[model samples]
Target chain A: EDKVVQSPLSLVVHEGDTVTLNCSYEVTNFRSLLWYKQEKKAPTFLFMLTSSGIEKKSGRLSSILDKKELSSILNITATQTGDSAIYLCAHQETSGSRLTFGEGTQLTVNP
Target chain B: AAGVIQSPRHLIKEKRETATLKCYPIPRHDTVYWYQQGPGQDPQFLISFYEKMQSDKGSIPDRFSAQQFSDYHSELNMSSLELGDSALYFCASSRSGNIQYFGAGTRLSVL
Candidate 1:
């Protein structure tokens, strides 16, 4: 069965701290991995990585994929109270567009 | 920029009832996807349609059915609602080989 696992299911840190979230997947035909930050409503697109070793960054958030290890990491620097939300990792297989999501890392940034 | 739109931000229904959730994709998007997120759970892919055709299916229950129309809009029709059916239903749209844009989900509560 294909599955995606995320570590440190929950994390807490004061403002300005940095955090790293990990996601590993086991699937038949790997295509791409995506990162999304979900607030109270919908999950917003962050990054999509199809190639390994190339880091994708936007603002204070960046992510990289390690295809050899079947895993990926999301790094958030200079965290703020506004960054408190669930960070989700999902993957799509080459066969279709269906996404398999990890449990997500709940991040709480205290001021 | 136009984004994916979903209807009935909130819905309450009794067990054994039925519900229909609508989704309007971003203008010109070619694919539509449906997901269900339980309390504190990652969003799970339910189904997807591309060009008005069923492209893929995930862990959707047999009681649930979905379709995309000629205009590229989609609808998820859920029947025989159970307490376990309560979840946040999200509709996402994307162009092939592009990142999906998620709509503000419909929160369904089955009492």
Candidate 2:
């Protein structure tokens, strides 16, 4: 079975702080990893990493994948209240292209 | 861009009743997926539909089913509702191997 585990299920930090959320997975036929931010409603896609050691970044948020370690990390720097949301990591397998998601890490950026 | 669109933003149902949710994928997208999310929990994949066919089904009961209409619209149906079926149902669409875009979601409350 494909499974994803996320650490530090919840966190609280002041604005301008940096945060790193971790996700580890055990899946068959690994193809890619995805990160999403869930705010008021649906989750918004953040990044998708297919290869190892390559970093994807969008402004204050960045993510990297380590295939050997079977893990990925999402980093947020100089956070603001607007950046507060549940960060979800999902892994997709090639055999079925099915996504198995982690429990997610909740981030709260206080002003 | 117009993101994925879902219908019945809010639904209230009693046990033994049936509930149906609808979704319209983003223009030009070819894949559609469905997920359920409870409070404080990550979105759970229910199914994925591609090219008018069901691609995957998750750990959901047989009461839950989905159908895709020509890769543009999809519908999720629950034959019989249970208390545990209460959750926000999300619809997502993806291009050819691209990141998914989500809908605002349909909040289903089983009473």
Candidate 3:
């Protein structure tokens, strides 16, 4: 079975702190990995990483995929309360566009 | 900029009732995907359509069925509703081999 697992299931941090969320996967015919931030109703696209060692960034958020290790990490710098939400990681296999998602990491940034 | 659209932001149905949820893919998008997310759980893939044809399926229940129209819109028809079926149903659209943009999701509550 294709599976994606995320670590630090829940985290609490003060504003301005930095935090890292982890995702590891085991699947066949790996194609790409993606990250999303789900707030209340919908999950907004964050980044898509396909190559190892290449980092994708958006403002204070960044992510990288390590294919050799079958894992990925999402880093948030200068975190703020606005960054508190469930961070989801998913991967697509070459067979199709379907995504297998992780349990997600719930982050809470307090002021 | 257009994004995936889902209708009936919320639906309430009694056990054994039937419900139909709709989805309108983004302009020029040729694929649509359906996912169900229960409280505190990751999104689970239900099914997907490519160019109005069933392309892939996942852990969808036997009581559920879905189809895409030529207009690139889709609908998920769920019958014999169970309490476990209550969840957020999300519709996502994407161009072939690209990132998917999700809808705000329809909250289904089975009483």
Question: Best by TM-score, which number?
Answer: 3
Worst 10 residues of 3 chain B by lDDT: B92-101
Model 1 Cα lDDT, one tens digit per residue, A1-111: 789999889999999999999999998888889899999999999999885579999999999999889999999999999999999999888634888899999999999
RMSD of 2: 1.4
* Clash pairs for candidate 2: none
In model 1, where do residues sit more than 4 Å from their true spots? none
- Candidates' TM-scores? 0.97, 0.95, 0.98
Candidate closest to the true structure, highest DockQ: 3
Per-residue lDDT over B1-111 for candidate 3, one digit per residue giving the tens place of the 0 to 100 score: 888889999999999999999999999989999999999999999999999999999999999999999898999999999999999999998887599889999999999
**Residue A23, model 3: Cα distance from true site in angstroms:** 0.7
The better candidate by DockQ, 1 or 3, is 3
Evaluated on chain B only, candidate 2 has a TM-score of 0.96
Supply candidate 1's per-residue lDDT for A61.
92
The interface RMSD values of the models, given in order, are 1.7, 2.1, 1.5
Predicted chain B of candidate 1, TM-score versus the true chain B: 0.98
TM-score for candidate 1: 0.97
How high is the TM-score of chain A in each model?
A: 0.95, 0.94, 0.95
TM-score: the better of candidates 1 and 3: 3
Q: Which of the two, 2 or 3, has more DockQ? A: 3
Worst 10 residues of 3 chain A by lDDT: A91-100
Instruction: In model 3, state the lDDT of residue A21.
Output: 98
Clashing pairs in 1: none
